[model samples]
Target: MLTIGEFAQLTHLSVRTLRRYHDAGLLEPARVDQASGYRYYSAEQIPAAQVIHRLRELDVPLPDVQRILQTPDPGTRAGLVADHLQRLEDQLERTRAAVTSLQRLLRPEPATLDVELRAVPATTVAAVEATVELDDVLAWYSGAMAELDALVGTPGPPGGLYDNELFTTGRGRVLVHRPVTAPPRTGRVHPVTLPAVELAVTTHVGDHDTIDVTYGELGSWVVEHTLAVAGPVRETYLVGPRDDPDPTAWRTEIGWPVFRLAPG
Candidate 1:
């Protein structure tokens, strides 16, 4: 038998925690001195204390810990632990993404506010489009891109055309677009013919998660360059998501159609 203080030393759990566990009906002592109100534990309780300490290390919720402690079937107990581990992994991934996003936003890099004038050629491709709320855009785009790729049977550069009117109106129009060598002739994948036009473009080097700042900088550059905005802004995904081991390595090109300025 071990006194509360001795048990605390042996388990490395503080005396206060042992009392709390007893009060919570989690770990009861082997015997209690009724007159002195002293608690004692048998030598066998150490293993249970060790298990509790490990579960707590995982940051498992107390209610979950209680349920796990009471669960009898070995398979069921293992499943519960696996589920908690999966949740932790998912949370870790989100935290990593947030950290990377913050790092990019805080990095002091020279702003590439250069304005380049280029004549874009007319092209045709198979495309699928959706009018979606901003929050659901990524998932919707992924599904549409998958369908478009299946129909085209050829992988090519990914791009999207955004109509500004939708954003100001709380809705956005997006297309899962890819350039094709010929006219479209497949199911639900319609041929998209882009007319030749002048464009002002800037390349953004980072994850699309927070590329809005780059877009804002580029748009300002176009206005300052005296280019007259003509049509929807196009985002050409130069590096697809799966191509990079780290999402932060992806690159995107922001192109906005414009009319050339007359000589000053």
Candidate 2:
């Protein structure tokens, strides 16, 4: 038998912490004194306490640590831990995105702008497009991209197509598009030709969530440069949130069809 203090010494956990764990039903003492109301632990309980300590050190929540301790099978324990590690990785990625967004907003210099006009050739593409509510755009895009990749079975880079109404109307019509040499089908799965057109384009770096500001800025620039808006805007996602998972490294190109403004 080990006294509470001795158990604490063996586990290298403080007495108060042990008592709290006991109160929380996490680590219970082996026996308690009837008259004196003192707690005592068996030598065998030391290992359990040590395990709990290690888990807490890893920043596992108390509830999760309890689950881990209660889980008997080694495979089950491994799976639980793996799930937690993946969650941590996702959290780290979100934190990095937040940091990048903050830095871009706080930067001192005016971001130097680049604008180009190019005529692209008409091409057939394998595309999955939908009209999605603004709030559900991200979720819808992920599913569409997954479906496109599954059908195309291409591990190479994928591209995107964005219709202008999504921004102007607050209801977005977007496409997760991948260029394919062959023809496409429609109404769920199909190939469509993206007709060749002249585009006025500008590149923006950062997460798409905040990239709209850049889009607006560029729209204003096109007007200032005496470019006439001819057709809807198209955003080609060059590098996505999935590629780097760091928003700072994400890049998107915003292009709008334009014709020269007749001398006004």
Candidate 3:
């Protein structure tokens, strides 16, 4: 039997941690002296203590550590550890994505995008419109766009209109349209006339992950140029996944309906 100090040396765990583990029933000592209040551990307990130490270092919850130690089957033990490791990996990936997004936002170079004001004429289109939750937009758009593509058969580049409530309330109407030669009255695809509107437009080149930064820049420009937003936002997929698999090659135009203020 080894004293608590000796066991601490072997396991590289602090004496206080060993006592806490003992209190938590995670690593009980081999024996305790009732009269003097002394704890002693067997040499065999070293491996168990080390395993608990390693798992704790990985931020595994105390309850999980206890479960791992109590589990008799090796497969069950391994499965628990593997599940925690997979969660760690997922968190790391999310952290990396967040870091990359922050770097794009705080880069040394200023976001200098060319803004244009243009009047779009009224046009007829085959479109699919729905009121969807923000989280479901991507999957919903994919199916909707696929349906449109199959029905329209290589019409003009696809575009969408997003109501402001989508951002403000987390649920709103979205309309995806394609300029076909003529409207096809097929399932979920119908002809609609989009009215003319003036817009403040800017292009976002790359994936949608960083598209918010471009939107911020363009919105700021509109305010600085004394333009008031008038209607729903529009997005034109000039070169999207349908045109190119490479995200870097994708080019999307963001258009905000706006009316120019008269010069003071």
Candidate 4:
């Protein structure tokens, strides 16, 4: 058995830290002096102490650390660590995307976006739609798209209609559909004819992380060109994550229904 001081030296952990771990029920001493209330740890406990230290160094939650140590399976412990690391990686990617977008937005002289006006005729397609909360948009989109693919085989590029209230009121109907000559009549799939409309269109080239910047630019163009928004915004995915892993190659076309305002 090693005294608290000797164990701290062997494990490279402070005596106070070891005591705190004991109080938290994380690590316990092998023996204790009843008369003096002193703590002592055996050499066998050194590895366990080091494991706790490593997990804490990575900022793992105390409860999670305890769960990892209590479970005897090495694979289970590794899997937990992997999941936490993946969450950290995803947050880092969002931070990088935000930085990239802000830098472009803050530029003194931003480049002009090519905005076009066109008339789109009514068309029918295999579709899945729902009333979605703002926070649930991405998850709902994925589920709808996957179901569409399973049923329709993605005959052509897929598109979505986003209601304006979804942005303004935080909850509204959203429709996602694939272009099919004959729309399916199975499951959540149905034929929905898009109404004919005039649109001011622009293409965003990259991941959806910063797609809002493109939307802002398109809206600004409409206000400047004396056009009034008339209907739901449309998004056509020309090349997306499902089709290409390289973000640089992805293309999404955004269209806002519009009508020319009366000249003042």
For TM-score, the strongest prediction is 4
Model 2 TM-score, 2 decimals: 0.67
Candidate 1, position 195, lDDT: 79
Residue-level error in angstroms, candidate 4, position 23? 3.3
- Give the TM-score (vs. native) of candidate 3: 0.68
C-alpha lDDT (0 to 100) for residue 211 of candidate 4: 95
**Residue runs of model 4 more than 4 Å from their true location after superposition:** 1-20, 32-38
User: Candidate 2 overall Cα lDDT vs. reference?
Assistant: 0.79
lDDT of 1 by residue, 1-264 (tens): 899999999999999988988887778999999999999998899999988888889998767877888999989999999999999998887787678667756879835676567888987878887788877878888887887777776467788888886567757787668887764756657888877888888887777655776777777777777888898788888885757777667888888899968988
Runs of candidate 2 with Cα error greater than 4 angstroms are: 1-20, 33-38, 118-124, 133-139, 149-158, 162-171, 180-182, 191-200, 204-233, 237-251, 256-264
Residue lDDT tens for model 3, 1-264: 999999999899999999999999999999999998899999999889999999999999999999999999999999999999999998886677677679877889876789888899998999999999999999999999889989997768999999999998999999999998788998999998999999999999987877888898898899888899988999999998888999889999999999978888
Candidate models: Cα lDDT each? 0.81, 0.79, 0.92, 0.93
By lDDT, the candidates rank as: 4, 3, 1, 2
What's the residue-level lDDT of 234 in candidate 2? 69
Models 1 onward score TM values of 0.67, 0.67, 0.68, 0.88
Superposed on all Cα atoms, model 2 deviates from the true structure by an RMSD in Å of: 4.9
